[model samples]
Target: MTDHLPRIVVGYDGSASAGAALDWAAEWAELQADEPHEVRAVIVGTAMDPVLGGYRARNDDLLERWRSEAEQRLAGTDTAPGQARERVEVRHGPVVPELLRAAEQAAMLVVGSDGHGLATGTLTGSVSQHVARHAGCPVVVVRPRRSTVANRIVVGIDESPEAGRALRFACRRAQRTGESVIAVHGCFSVLAHVLTFDGAESELAARSLAAGERLVQEVCAARAPDFPDVEIEPEAIPVRPGQVLVDASRAASLVVVGSRGRDAFAELLLGSVSQHVLHHAHCPVAIVR
Candidate 1:
């Protein structure tokens, strides 16, 4: 099998959100690969110490139970689903670390918000946040698993090369699925993020808007001219790019953002706009490097 045949790895802790994510990943795996795609569902064992409860052997027992339940969950998801190869792994490590390790070999990592373990925030689930920040691969966060909504696909674009790569990925996926692409380039004055540049807010906003428009044009020019005739809309919303993208993601089928690269200011390798959208977007979010 080709190393890049597009496998989908999902995190599972038996939460509703995690189940939804697994279903989405299975569906995605079947759709993205012609050959049997790998759909590995990994369970991050509970952190609670069974030994403390006087059941020292219970740790392994609990993990075994989790694996069986996970397999059942996978079987339950097989409602006329595609023919992707399925795997269930039970590990006793931190959720995020395990997921990230799995992501190293997979094409994409799929996760859920508010899983068996989580608090709140965009990518509200701990696994979502950790993968978004640390994983070298892209992560798709699926939220509100029960909703049968066909939302649009949103991609955040800036002048960075990674952003361009992210836009292209989002557009291609949208075309295949007949989903709308909202290529949003969030723009605001540098003053918005920096206090020293306060006085030049108006001029900075103007510059940001202008740059955003130019970015849209550049995207069209650089990307395949006839790639599905994606409708390009240049946006100059005055807010942090991450915040703007998150807000725009409410009804999107997928939100795409660049990985926060070495350029901490823009290039997203992890824990950037893509991460936020992954959690906040009502649908799924893809992080591109």
Candidate 2:
């Protein structure tokens, strides 16, 4: 069953975005050749009931055709020869749930921004959103367009544990690809605005910026020893985290963000900043939970 290999699950539905996602996943698996990883391309379809007694065979044949097409598409993905270890899985059920189940044992779950039934220009499909928020492991949402910035990975930094996890994930990727890591920390102080009327706005703003810089440095310093080879560029911005990350995404190969932050409501599965970046980032987004 090759269960010993690290598994990566990708959703495929014969759409352009899905094809791009498959290619990304295959290439990612190939890059991990030294680590021995496997890519599982999962194609999900709803179960259909026969309309009549004689329609049973027709339904079965249609399902088989879909499976065959999925297999062919999986085989056509561009990957390093002898480096990609992949398999196609056809399941009868809803897409998001099937993929989530498959991700139970997978190292990562990947999907496209748009799919067969998903609308265009929406940034992210409904299925991708659901899975990214609820997947057991990290989720990578790949956009259709190929990324031009392949030399760097951008990750959001905060006080949450998930933020630390995201940083570690980005560092590991940077280590493997020889890419630089951009650690961005966004800080906005409500006290600075309130103190504006009291004539202390400038003083408070400066303090806020210094605090932001310290927080970023502290977080990165703790993990610096573990990823000594990864080049880290830390930026403390005075804007919303989502906007800063979205702007950074324009020149980033990948944007990694925590699913939830320290300020997020307990009941929310995804933080507002992460959600915003997932929908507006130019390149692929990875939600680390």
Candidate 3:
């Protein structure tokens, strides 16, 4: 069994959004052609019997039909000719748990931001959000976009280790796609936490902005050598981190951010800024854990 091989697992339910996600996943897999990995689409069906324990006759029929549909959808995805056919895995259980189980040790999990059930299949509606917060690996939530700026990746940067991981992920992607990386750091929120100078609010804000600028530059500069080919455009804006990232997402092919940030609560699975960006970004958002 090639279960040990790295895999890019995608949640598919035959919805339009799921189709878009599959396309995005395919593109990502192609980008990593140098490093071999399997692209598997997981189709989840609700297990009808709660007390009876497993798939009954009706449940079996639903799962089989969904499996067939998933296979057809995989065949139709616009991947390069001669590429290995993507494998389809069918699981019968609650949607989120089953998807999480399928991708427990995957390289990454791709899911549509929203999806209708398989005919009535409760697969992706809010499922992406839950999985993004709970998934053991990185999660990329692909939302339908009316337009996208070409060859650019936006990433939120801070001093936290999580932010560093995110920047590395973005730089690696930039290396693969020949895209420029926009490293954005926001100052207002960071400053508000430590500064209590009421009368000299403006002066403190200016200092915070400067500090933020330095932090961004230093962080990007450190990673610059490793990704010499990647163009890192550092932007230290005097705005909230989440807002800056959301605005930048308008002109980014993808937005990458840490699962949590500097001020995140220790027990929280996802940070406020990351959560905000996930909900409002104009393009695909990748939450790096």
Candidate 4:
């Protein structure tokens, strides 16, 4: 990789979701204006055990077949002329570690959701979740259904440095693509709503909503002047933040969220709302640390 070009690593498995991931990475790289970008498609598979010497030849054949398939898939994607340079890499090992290694020099790591969950049927696979949690750079998990409008980037915000990072990323992307930013803040207090009387519950709910609105406004205001041309839309909704963001993703070009939020436990790599959005959002999701 050249020092002037940022690299993007994508885990390609030839699955539908994986194909979408490849496409998203390519498009994202093309949108970068600071410098040229490169796309590396990594296909990871299990290594054949050396103990099975009798089957070594068979294993080698299987690996060759997998590599060929990956190359074909890489060639099938649409690449813009004179845009990001592309390459395909085949590795035999655990998926998470290989991807992490590949991402060491990458600007962002991208993977696709398997779309096999109960809520929205688009859940991050175990490998993707692991890499997203542990990668050195930001990670993007592209869902199966991407928005065609390409007009808005929705970001989930709270009082965390990770959220601030996400906001900055969204702003950069908006600057490149001319998309607006939707700063979303969701407010829900279980204790206040479930453990209090009617009047008290209403008052608590109102207070929570007001606080959410203020948080959104403050965060957006802090970043707005820097991105004068990028329209910032602040949304404070009286609902679960994850759900609200997921709903907003239906028409958004991309959904950005922090790896961990204010309520996340210290050991948790991803907060509950971020995880929820990763699984349910209809557009590409970016998890920023």
TM-score (all chains, Cα) for each model: 0.79, 0.87, 0.86, 0.85
Question: What is the lDDT of every predicted structure here?
Answer: 0.68, 0.80, 0.82, 0.78
Rank by lDDT (best first): 3, 2, 4, 1
RMSD of 4: 4.4
Measured on C-alpha atoms, candidate 2 has an lDDT of 0.80
Tell me the alpha-carbon RMSD of every candidate. Answer: 4.8, 3.6, 3.8, 4.4
Q: What is the clash count of model 1?
A: 11
lDDT of 1 by residue, 116-145 (tens): 442222223765767766778777777762
lDDT value, candidate 4, whole model: 0.78
Candidate 3's displacement at residue 172, Å, is 1.1
Question: What tens-digit string does per-residue lDDT give for candidate 2 at 60-109?
Answer: 57556645765676677665455445577877666677788988979999
The weakest ten consecutive residues by lDDT in model 1 span 115-124
Please, what are the lDDT tens digits per residue for candidate 4 over residues 1-289?
Answer: 3445678888876567777888788878767655667788887656546666656676557556645765676566565554544477877776678789989968999998762211221224776677777888999998755568669999998888888889989999999899899999888777657856855557778888899999999999999988999998988987778889989999998999998888667336535787788778998889998
Structure candidate 3, residue pairs in collision: 117-121, 118-121
lDDT of 3 by residue, 1-289 (tens): 3465578899987777887788888888777766656678888876655556543665667667766776776677655444554688887778888989988889999998888874343545478888888999999999755355467999999888989899999999999999999999987754554565655556677778899999999999889999989999999998888899999888789999998788767326544888888789989999998
